[model samples]
Target: MFTRCWLWIGRLLRRTLLITLSAGLASGAIGYCYYSLKFSGPVSAEEQIPATEAADSRAIIEDAIRVVEQHRSDTRVLRDAHAKAHGCVKAEVSVLSELPSNLSYGVFSQPGKTWQAWMRLSNGNAYPQFDRARDARGMAIKLLEVEGEKLLGSRSEQDFVMFNHPSFFVRDVAEYRQNFAAQANGQQVLAFLPGWDPRHWEVRHLLIALQTLSPAPETPLASTYNSIAPFKLGPIASKYRVIPSPENCPSYTPPAQNRDLPNFLRNALYQQLSIDRVDACFALQVQLQDPTHFMPIEDPSVEWDEALAPFVTVAKIRVAAQDFDSREQNLFCDNLAFNPWQALPEHRPLGGINRLRKEVYEAVNVYRHQRNQQSQTP
Candidate 1:
């Protein structure tokens, strides 16, 4: 079954590779082909909805939340599908002050203050896959002892979750159902749904927009991570990023087909940790709310050009040398929740995708705790 799964995934990836090649020469016909598949009509400036109307995401949020609930495991040990965190290590974040402004939000508002954080790196697939295979990786950072009014009740931690890619596949909650459907079938051991295109270019541009720079990463420490969605920085809106900057230990590529171990990535992380302390720095960039050219806050699909508004360094994150690949720490990391909403009110997650995450994450958090037979909050 594992061999068959690998072959099946290989076939699907070959198709994506072809798409990637064709993407290099983006033509008018290709654009028309994508436009033809739009459920919400042609993509246009007029099609972009306001931040408020786009916030009417309750129905999709509830429906998708129910789907995840139905997929719950009966054991106290299983993890939430997608971003199955395999490693959690001790880390710290130093919040460097940005230019003084009334607009600076949340953790950024009080610059120069340091906060202890836990860094959890995970594979994007719900079910484990070979590290050699192409897949999304996750970097979730939880800034502890944060002092601010909370977005959901009184939570002292500010969580900034990011993916290796800067853009997400789906644009809104309504499209999340389709994305979930693909995932539900793709993870099955036996077969995938017919025409299962997780990178449905016609449906969304993320297939091209958000593909990882590396098909497979040597370690989580090697890749830069992006929040993908916008957040309120005090009164201003911005996105979060983490760039890897370890001296001497550069990111590398693993063998194209090394399927001997299911925990290859974890092993790689442990190997890196054993060598020396890991270092990564975080950046906060303001989003320009251009209602005409770029809908900064709402449509995250509109990739913000770094040349226009470069991300400024707001914090430096360091992961000290430690053993991270242990059953105890892995389980603890699994139990630990890192929701964007688990943040300061000043840094409340902004935009439609973020708005949906507020409810979806809460639902998943409750579901995971119940399945694990443990009630813990972060």
Candidate 2:
């Protein structure tokens, strides 16, 4: 009887050991999968370029900067005008689940499973425009309540992203300064600046002219925008994009003469809400190649190769329908600041142009706000 009991006890102990070993193996596999997806996925090829080519590119950027300084003066005028025209009232604010379907490339870092955000939609231009024109659309988003060490500065959770088109008139900081100079000084000075390429100037002029023509009369709130900056994500970098989804309303282009763009956009948003809730999902795309791979860091004229790393959708943004015409919503949307420098350590802006943005954008914001306040007092 004693011998039989010992054998049964030994068998039960063996079964327990086998079960424990299986559970440990399973847990190890699960942990490895999680780490691989989060860290190993975004690694990219190293970027390299020739020295002579880089020097030439630098010269071109220097010339562009000179041209911009000669032309652009008093950069704060337009921003102040925008603030005043829109009034000082704060707009009603709310958190969104996802971005609209039409605006595809919006990404925001969430803290504690919640994203704090503020957005403003406006007609894009320097100032003084034909109200009936097909103006460029502006969408500025500030993702607040973020938790992370900022890329360059001391501020935490301060990131601003502004977008117009896939490609920008100038690619780096020196060129952007030159472009601003041209705008400030008007077209006459820009015509004489050495190395002032007409083709390049034309692109910038054309964008401004288009903005002058495009007016958001019908659906002022419905238009979408993008961030043209090339940003780094861990070892990989990409340009951020945003689009408006057409889940509810079929996608349709407006007529040439869109006189009621603002109202049309407002009505469409309202209609979607009245029936079923509307949702906007912004897709995040990363560019695979580094800056040194295709073009020099200074020159904005050369286009980067898009085939290597195509855009991938990573996150979704949703906004529920509500009355946007209220005074509260206007104030929050219009006055809230958006800066690209507000970013996580993984995603930082690259190249000289991005560096200059840190100074120029902040200065512009401060100057404009000050001017607006001064103008309002009796």
Candidate 3:
């Protein structure tokens, strides 16, 4: 009886060891796959595969329109992305009095040249939400009286559209189409979640999206903004950024609690401009693309290393003291359309993503204006 019991115990111990080993191996495999998908291998800028454009570009743009329509159908007010405007202020974008030869490109070519412009600050939501909510922010500067032909409309206006974040989440047109399709089909969650299929996983993009929509700044003008994608800086490719002039802009003091203040961001802007009567200023800077793989032309998700290629201040954007939240001003801002494609030839938007934007933005602009019964231009 004792011998039989010993043999049974040994068999049970052996089975338990095997099960433990199997579980460990399975966990290890899952971890390896997760890391591999989250952080991809290095890609050379020259060797990066160009996304195929044969897939119907029109369909992609239509999908974007449909998504926006469905998103705002309940409210019956159709607005494009970044639909809510905090305020549109009158401003000026003046080139630096002295600029380096390499930095003198496009709008920055003529030193000390100032252009009358409208600076629209906005929260990056498809529909207006509480301003205190953590979301991406936008700074769109439309410079009027710019000479020469434009890539889009016949207007002599040039728009510099930027987001507070330095890099975008989508890598290319293909990925952009996928995102629109997912939103249109009401399966937007799938863009981030990896269900049973690993191929549909977008862990990296989801991480980036979270970073993009981080906490809102104390004020819109207080935060820096970036183009994220590349554009033509004369013969070379580059990105642009607008840094807040801290010395000129006042420091913000938040309330002890903000659960009651939904529009605190807009209020901060108002207090700074109308109440305090301070001039807000920013340094418009440019960063040229590196010759190697570090600063990619295709992937907007990959932030160009500032340590490798630092941004050079090319111009100054100044907003004088004014009450920009008037009803008439808000109405005018609502009608305004700021498109990146509405640019001078020398500063044409580059990369497959921007090419898609040229089409998407145009279609969305027309559709939105027609729905609102307003002119496409402000």
TM-score of each: 0.74, 0.58, 0.83
Report the candidate with higher lDDT, 1 versus 3. Answer: 3
Highest TM-score: give the candidate number: 3
Find the candidate with the highest lDDT and give its number: 3
State each model's CA lDDT, in order: 0.65, 0.47, 0.81
lDDT of 2 by residue, 1-378 (tens): 999999999999999999999999997887678535633323233333334434444554444344333333355334422222222111222223453333222233322134555555554554534444455555565555456567645444545465444555554444454555555566533532425564354444345434434445444334445555566655555565555545533444432333444334434444444333444334333344454355333333333555654554444344554455556554444445556776766667665556656555555555545644533111
- Clash pairs of candidate 1? 82-126, 105-233, 105-234
In model 2, where is the ten-residue run with the lowest total lDDT?
Answer: 84-93
- Off-target runs (Cα >4 Å) in candidate 3 are 1-51, 54-56, 71-76, 186-189, 193-200, 248-259
lDDT of 3 at 297: 75
TM match of model 3 to true structure = 0.83
Lowest summed lDDT over 10 consecutive residues: which window, candidate 3?
Answer: 40-49
Of candidates 3 and 1, the better by TM-score: 3
Tell me the alpha-carbon RMSD of every candidate: 9.6, 21.7, 5.5
Alpha-carbon deviation at 14 in model 1, angstroms: 28
In candidate 1, stretches whose alpha carbon ends up further than 4 angstroms from where it belongs are 1-26, 29-74, 77-81, 102-104, 182-206, 209-214, 247-260, 275-293
Compared with the true structure, the alpha-carbon lDDT of candidate 1 equals 0.65
